[model samples]
Target chain A: MIEIDNLSKKFGDLTAVDSISMNINEGEVFGFLGPNGAGKTTTVRMLCTLISKTSGNARISGYNIGDKDDSLKIRKIIGLVPDNVGLSEHLSAYDNLEFFARVHDLSKTERKERIQYFLEMLGLWDKRNVSVGTFSKGMKQKLAIARALIHDPQVLFLDEPTANLDPEAAKTVRDFILDLKKQKKTIFLNTHNLDEAQRICDRIGILNTKLVSIGTPKDLEDAVRVRKTVIELEQVTDSVLKSVQKLSLPNLDVEGNTITFDTIDSGSKNWPIVEAIVHAGGHVNIVKVVGSTLEDVYLKLVGENQ
Target chain B: MKLSKAWLVAARDFKIFKHQKNMLYGLVIFPVIISIIPSAILNYAVNRDPPLPAAGIPPILDAFSIFLIIGSAFVPLGIAGYTIVGEKVEKSLEPLLAGPLTDGEILLGKTISAVLPALIAMYTGGVIFMVGTDAVSYPSLNYYYFPNWTIAVILFLGMPAATIMSVEFGVIVSSRVNDVRSATNFGALMFFPFLIIYILGQTKLITLDTETMAKISVILLVIDVVLFFISTALFKREEILTKWK
Candidate 1:
């Protein structure tokens, strides 16, 4: 539901967001992953119409972001959760939601219903009356999420939504994101957490070479064979050594206590490593097959680009 | 529909003011306090029989005029400073920039908030001072302090210009600075010349007669027009978001 074409934002000599291009389909959770200062937030801001694109264009829901008529229309269609949450800490959760609802021009009944529903869903109903200044980091974050969804925009742009949250709060946000996907809302998430992106995103794009790779997790694994296989021995004895030495898997590399091999069969071919160790009189403790992760792809793309 | 947004913004500002005790006092009660000091000083000097100024309006009228200029000067400075810098401190500027409202709308909303309360407090102080001083003075001194067209122009053109200038400068200053205090202090620096003119004119140390007021008003009108355009030009949303340092 979004189209970006050669989107580049320059502040004098410094190019915050280099020439980047990507398309996000409706109902797809597209993860825009990058390290700090990697232009992820800038890209989101440009798409959200908060900042202008220095060159090129971005269209949201088929409306050009550069066009004023389409910009307002686009604004109504998308909801943005900024990186900092940027919430008014002194205002109560309910008040904050009410303010944004009014800004979004929701009818009173629609606003009330949505606020109540989202607040309850995010487990912030009890704290709705209290000021956000008094809330913990997690509570404030939940309120920000509720605020973003108050108007129920068709597309949601989330920036570091789970940045500083505890594990439970992070999981709560992730689960809510998954729930959004279930409801078929197009979500554009910018995050440093590769795992969260991999878990929640339908297609992930690492922002190294601007539009490095865009596809499902398995598609990424298939395209980039950066997988890992580890065979754990019950005892690091000489038999364990002989067994590992005997199996000459293609593209294999081994170091102390760790052996990594490249196999065309991805994650399902870990049984051979276990079988080899066991047949050579070595006690196999556990075997794990680590597939190519978004992190690995991210590192490889960014590293290669550098 | 736009009024609704403006009111929403005003309410949001008021909610912020509720938390900012010092700022609430700065905008509302502190102007009154500053007014009271002069009132108290005049009361002390007069000691039940006030001295009439030889050149122009009565001392009470002079005091009210001084109050007007002071109110116009300080009220907008304090309110506008808090309005712009408060948003910066609270990190609300990004949302405002991201929202549907334009820079003019946001600036007008803040200017009105500052101007409205200032006019109210100034008028209230004038009424209270006139009544209180009349009880202690001659019958000839009792007079109406209705803002003339000249004063109206000052209130209309001057208050808004001062507010706009202050807020624009505050926004720029706050954008560069970290917190409200430094921005407010930096913003307050812009009001010095006006304060000097008001002080000198009010004390009769250098009379800003009707002719001077007109000239000054005309000059301010031109300056206001220029500053209005300049402020708008300076208000580049992308520039701000990108070069916020």
Candidate 2:
């Protein structure tokens, strides 16, 4: 549903979004993961036509993002939930949805039915008449999502929809998004929460100014070349940590008697570590090698980009 | 531009204005205050000992009537400021810009929101001012000095032009300013030129008569057109989403 090729945006000397290219299919939930200043929001803004791209081409549902007439058509077919929610505090929740619905030229009946349907579905029907200023952050965030979907656009671009919400509230939003996914809505989700991305996204792109990597959760985890090994010592002395540090093993993490490090070659690396621990008078308890996770892949890719 | 989309924007703003007590009060009260204070001064002078000369009343009535136009220009600064900057501060403007509407349509909608209430208030105030001045000055002048060409010219021609200029100026100023107070204060600068003309007319440096006022109205209309283009250029979706502070 969304096609982007070499998209870039520069603010004078600073390039907010570098040459990034990817495709998102219809009825797919594509998640964009990145750190602050990583161009995730910039990419979303350029695609949504809220801001112009400095270079490159993008199309939404076969409509060009750069063309004037097609820009409107692209906008008509897509809905955006901005990072800040951007709801009118003075207006009631229902009024907020109705205003956007009217902007999209929805009929009176369509507006009423959609507003009621979304509000009720999102558990905001009880607060429909209340001013948004009085709503909780979760409620306001839900309302923003409803406002975006009021016209029933084909594709939805969500920028950090669950950023600052409480865990429960975030879960509510996640569940609602899952519901949208079930309905086969094409969703482009930009998020900072790694777990959310892993749980919700069909395919995730780890971005840092450039497209560092893109794959499904398992595929990304499998992309990491090195496995991690944890040596559970019966009693870790300061000398054991010092001995392991002397070797300068990658990603060495120690918690009490347990030490974990990235292992590229298990037989060669583990024997040396066991010798170091035994020489330091620490008894071997448990040694295990574990596969990498999405966090590990994300950190490795984003860290490499940085 | 699709005017229906513009109207949707204006209609939403009107609904929001119902909750803004300050904007509503400012909209209603400025014209009322300008209308009454001038009439009060005229009434006080007419009933005084010498009863203020009959010939002196018409020029004074014309001078007082010009306040309607000045008030017309000043009244919408608040509404215009609130409508544009309020959205900016709330960050709600992004979704609107992200919608299918064009830059021209949204700006036109805001212009309508600012112009409609201002014209209504000023026109209503003009009515009250003309009736009050006629009631008080009639005994001395032996005629209703109002309902004349000069005041009509000011009301129908000069006032609308002034209002449109103020609104467009507000939109331009709002692009650079983040808050409503700053927007309104800076937006008020557009009327300074009109105020200077008002001062010139009061000092007899320029005539406040029908022909001169009509000429000034045309000039104001021209300025309005020029500012409209500039304001639209400044109101770009990209500029607004990216650069507006």
Candidate 3:
């Protein structure tokens, strides 16, 4: 688990992360989303103990982040996959993993088992002997992921883990993350892909140099407050149209036996309108709610702050 | 500090060195070339028709021997100069820094890796030069000028100290600089002090006696200590991660 309070970082006149605070629970996948220069990486760096915070405090696995003595303890429990893959190009994939494994002081047996397990799981076992410089971008990214997991840290920080991968490779990484979650590993994922975040993250934090919003995907979508009810009808008779118009829903439009109307209260208003249309002798094909997606909520939240 | 962690780092660096053709050439071949040049010159001079004066043995041989020892310093300068900055340029520093290893451990590990090969190469060069000089000068002098106290001090005490000092200087420069070329250029400056010592000895201002060698070794050991502390102080992890750009 990770906790932060009023954590901020400043570079002279520029504040890269401005007094943002959040807690990540054990075994929860937390997605950190933001645009360019949005302090996502800065926050992750502070938590990883890679950089000192200019102000505020944080703790990882119950160790204080600001305390110098606790830095080693914190590092022992956390792993980071930075935006750059950060693999030693000339070293073999196995050599690279072996070096980090030694740094963490893993036993010989543990190191061997963990290296082979991660390599196979990430689909990199065959290429373990090959130098990392010859690996493709997707393979390199996977190796970085494996490197981060080499020590089996309590928390894993992945910055843009799937940035350069093909769709299939991206799915592989996503599935691997989901597997990590199943095994009760806490993950702090900083990503630009909203769909990936929505699919995997139990909770999402939207940041723009500050904490704009943090909640589950559904919770965020429900918070957007823009709703539309779409009704598909088999026939649009004049009587049914008049009966539906009697409800006087706002922003109503009809085209080709389909009607769409804006409603701030879709939950209550949709059923009533559906009943009125069916009673008025119009065959109802389908009725659905629209206009609230994670993308929509993200754009609205980020756009409003901007 | 954690000795095992430091040793692991050193081992990794050595593995990388084995794969780097340029670094291998600098470590093994460069010192050989530096030693051969002076040894060849000494051989030609001693075997000349009249044979150079036997009195010239101490100064000429001493100067070339000092040159051979000083040449070892450059091996570390060329290789260790790139250790930190090269990792930064390659984007490998983050993963290393993210580990539990402290700054001192990382620095000491790199110093060991750099100094080990340099000392080996220097000792190898010293042996080759001694054999070549002894073979050529045997008839005239009928005595070996090497394996003496001064050369012993230079090889055992002075060379290691200079190599360590050079390595620490390179790490210091590598920590602050943004590129390998600049760090190496700054590391090249480490040779000037040894150059000064060689010049003083050649000018007869400082004789190549055991007493003088003792004093020089003490001075180099002192410098080595001072540079080690200063480099350790300058190697701040936050500055390297944030400010180097």
lDDT of 3 by residue, B1-245 (tens): 98888889889888778777777787877668766776678778877888788888777877776765577678888678657777888889888888989988988888888898888887888888787777766676889877788788888887888888888888778877888788888988877877998889878888767677778778878988998888887776777777766
Q: Return whichever of 2 and 3 wins on TM-score.
A: 2
lDDT of 3 at A76: 90
Best candidate, TM-score-wise? 2
lDDT of the candidates, in the order given: 0.71, 0.89, 0.85
lDDT per residue for candidate 2 within A178-234, as digits (tens), equals 999999999999998999999999999999999999989989998785688989988
Q: Model 3: clashing residue pairs?
A: none
For each candidate, give its TM-score against the true structure: 0.87, 0.94, 0.88
Interface RMSD of 2: 0.7
In order of TM-score, best first, we have 2, 3, 1
**TM value for model 1:** 0.87
Which has the greatest DockQ?
Answer: 2
TM-score of the second chain, each candidate in turn, equals 0.75, 0.97, 0.93
- Tell me the tens digit of each residue's lDDT in model 3 across A1-306: 799899999988999999998999999999999998999988988888888899999999889999999999999988999888899888899999999998999999999999999888867789898889998887788788889889999999999999878998788778888888889899999998999999999999999998999999989988886777889999999999999889888889999999988865646768878899999999999888786788888888889888
TM-score of the B chain in model 1?
0.75
**What ranking emerges by lDDT with the best candidate at the front?**
2, 3, 1
What lDDT tens digits, residue by residue, belong to model 1 across residues A1-306? Answer: 899999998877888877888899988999888778788988888887877888989888788988766766777778888877778877889988998898888999998999899888877788888888888777677677778778888788899999988998888778888888899999999998988988999888878536667788768766777766776665656776777767777667656556667654656667777777777787766667777776677788777766
